[model samples]
Target: MYVTTPDEMRRIDNRAIEEFGIPGAVLMENAAIRTVNVIEEKYPALFDGGRVIILAGCGNNGGDGLAIGRHLMLKGAKVQAFLFFAEEKFTGNARLNLDIYKRLGGHIELVTHEEDIKTLKGSIYQADLIVDSIFGTGITRDIDSLIYKAVDMVNKSPVPVVAVDIPSGINGKDGRIMGIAIKAQHTVSFGYPKRGHILYPGREYTGRLHVVPISLPQDSSQAVGVKTFTLDDKEMAQNLMERPRQGHKGTFGKVGVIAGSLGMAGAACLTSMAALKGGSGLVTLGCPASLVPIFQSKMTEVMCYPLEDGQKGYLTLDAITGIRDFLKDKDVLAIGPGLGSKCDGLEIIRYILREFDISIIMDADALNHISRDKRLLSDYKGSIVITPHPGEMARLTGKSIQEIVASPIETATEFARDMGIIVLLKGAVSIVAHPEGNIYLNSSGNAGMGTGGSGDVLTGLIASMVAQGYSPYDAAVYGCYIHGRAGDYAREKWGETGMIAGNLLDELPLVFKDLFSLKG
Candidate 1:
């Protein structure tokens, strides 16, 4: 499903009104009616002679609250509305809704002075529910003044609150919280879900979200060029590769993984094993000569090649010849899981990028080396996908981790567009950005998936998908979704605290089973 920013939403709304000739008041009425439907479905008891308090501003969002008041009144609820602005402040659709509500014998109170706060408190204390419409997606400044006091009081009250469009005081573009925001029990979004409704801190304050159609034309968003989307199960299921009734081992694909050093042999083991478990036909692990015995002891399904190393247990320039030979028949190469940060290791990475003309997945120390010399990627010979966490992204972009975390979508999209490569920015919500400006926000996974070797598993899984004929962009998108679903399965079995990276491997089969079942 498409995820829109505030600016995109406004363009869509304008196109619907000016191009399609839909009246603005009709749109406002549709929003209120759909929101009331959600309220009735979720809180049926609120209409049984219950009391509802509406906190309204002077904008269209406030008009939505006023319309909702009339609907609740007609449903036999005792409704009272508190307008933050005077009657003269309202205009356009807001003014029209106010007049209609007043004509229906609705009680309206103005909160223009400190003395009126006592009555506001009394009404809130006696009400069962509150509708928050003080601000909308257009707000960008920090919330203050009497509005701040009103929001604070509403938050303190025990009444269950439902928000209109979006929670007040949230920046709709990046999900940044203003000075304060209303904490709603449920939020009814018009048309589609906004970026704030899906991203972090803003998502927490938004509570349960419901996106109901507000009578916008079907092609409004497409006409406005919405390019961001949320990764969903149905789309992923439709894109999954089908297994033929008579397919052999060679039909799947081969994956070559060059990873591991002295103390981090487990990284190599986990990567190769995850590739095999992800349905690769042949999995090869290329490591230093000294680590072969360790990898052999840990894994039996994967074939291993011990590359010549100038240094005993680490990769060096000497391994380049053997790596070239190893990549001859491989479909995809996954590099740098446990590879160390030595100078020789950097030389080996440069040699591979300069010589190879195949798909590559770069992670861990490879990303660290590229951060030092990003020009190597600019001159590379093939498709490259980099999986970087916030810290690695900061190092690569020369920005603080806070900056990357604050605006993950923008950070990833800019890097992908500038670098001309796919970027999978791993985080609480993984964001996959294509060089062509398309962005996808992953919707699965849990905190339990935050263990050490989890990224190595993802590297292998994406490599497996790329080897099996999926495009680089689709591989990254599906790889993130599948990886998270596996982590979620592991969480169900061992809870978040006890789950480990190895548990995800055990649950990979189950994740695929569910996904493939959805195919037919």
Candidate 2:
């Protein structure tokens, strides 16, 4: 599904009214009806003569609340509409709805001053549910302090709140909260989900989301280009990498992973084990010669290579020659998981970027090395995937961590577009951006996946997908989805607090099993 910005949504709405001939009043009525349906379907108990207080503004969102009040009244419920603006300020579809609601004997109250907030506290306390229509997606500034008092009162109330379009005080273009936003139990959006509905902080406030088709023609949305989308479990399950019944070990593809130094040996072990568990036919863990015995003792399934090292346990400049020889039969190379930065290691990364063939998943210390000279990525020819968390992304983009975290989707998209590479900005909501300008927000994973070596598991999984013939872009998308899903599985088995990176690796097979079963 498309996730549109507020401006894009406005353009689409205008196209619906002017070009498609869907009247604005008709759209408003439809939006209100859908919100009513959500309340009926999800909170049927609200219809048992419970008091519903509609906190309405003076705009179309308020119109939606007024229309909903009329519908709730028809359902034999005690509905009260509280208009925040003066009665004369109502105009457009909002005015039409308010007039109809009043003509239908719907009780409307005014909350025009600071004193009105104190008077409304009794109504708020007595209500079973509140409809938050104070602001809509077009709101771009902080709300006034007077409105803040009312919002805070509603939040403090134990009543369930349902929001229309989006929660008030949320930036529609971005998910940032404007002063304060309504904490809604559910949000019924018209036509499609807005960026705020899916983006952070906003998503947190938008309890549950239901996008209703409010008479807007689907083609109108296509008229305005939509390149941003999110991946769901069903789609990912169906599009997962294929598995042939007659497939042999070699049919799955081989992955070459150069990771781990001395103290960070766990990074290498986790990456190699995850690659094998992620369905790679073979996984070779190439580490410093000193770390080989450690890995050999740790995982019997993964093949091990001890390359010549300049340092005691890190892959040095000399190791690149051996890695080149090792890549002869490998389908994908996954570099940089705990491979600490040293002078020789940086030189090896530079060599790999310029000289490596086949797809490469550059992550961890490798990304740190490239961040020093981003120009190394300027002329790279092969398929490339960069997995960087916010801190790593900050280093790569030369931006502050706060800047990257505030707008992960934009940061990932811009970097991918400029570098001509796939960039997966790992976060609570992982964003996968293709060089072609398409961006995907992953819908899987949980906070428990933040454990150490978790990124290494993602690196291995992505490389495994690439080895299995997925394009670098698809690999990143599917890799993030699967990695997150596995983390969720691990969390389910062992609570989120106890789950570790190895648990995520252990659950990869279960995640793939479900995906493959979906294909059948």
Scored by Cα lDDT, where does model 2 land?
Answer: 0.87
Task: State in Å the error of residue 87, model 1.
Answer: 2.1
Q: Tell me, by TM-score, which candidate is best.
A: 2
For this target, which candidate reaches the highest lDDT against the unseen true structure?
Answer: 1
Can you write out model 2's per-residue Cα lDDT over 166-270, one digit (the tens) per residue?
999888877789998999999988888888887788889998888899888867667888777777677787887677989987999999998898899999889
lDDT of 1 by residue, 1-520 (tens): 7889999999988888899999999899999999999999988998899999989999999999999999999998899999999999999999999999999999999998988888999999999999999899999799987788888999999999999999888878877889899999999999988988878778888999898998999987789999888866677788899977687778889999999998888888888988888888899999998888889999999999989765578887888889889989998899889987763667887888888878999999889988888888767879999999999999999999999998899999999988889999999889999989999888789899999999999999999888888987889989999999999999888999988889989998899988888878
What lDDT score is found at residue 4 in candidate 2? 81
Q: Count of backbone clashes for each model?
A: 0, 0
- Weakest 10 consecutive residues, lDDT, candidate 1? 340-349
Per-model CA lDDT versus the true structure:
0.90, 0.87
Give, for candidate 2, the lowest lDDT window spanning 10 residues. 341-350
Query: Each prediction's TM-score against the native?
Result: 0.95, 0.96
Question: Clashing residue pairs in candidate 2, if any?
Answer: none
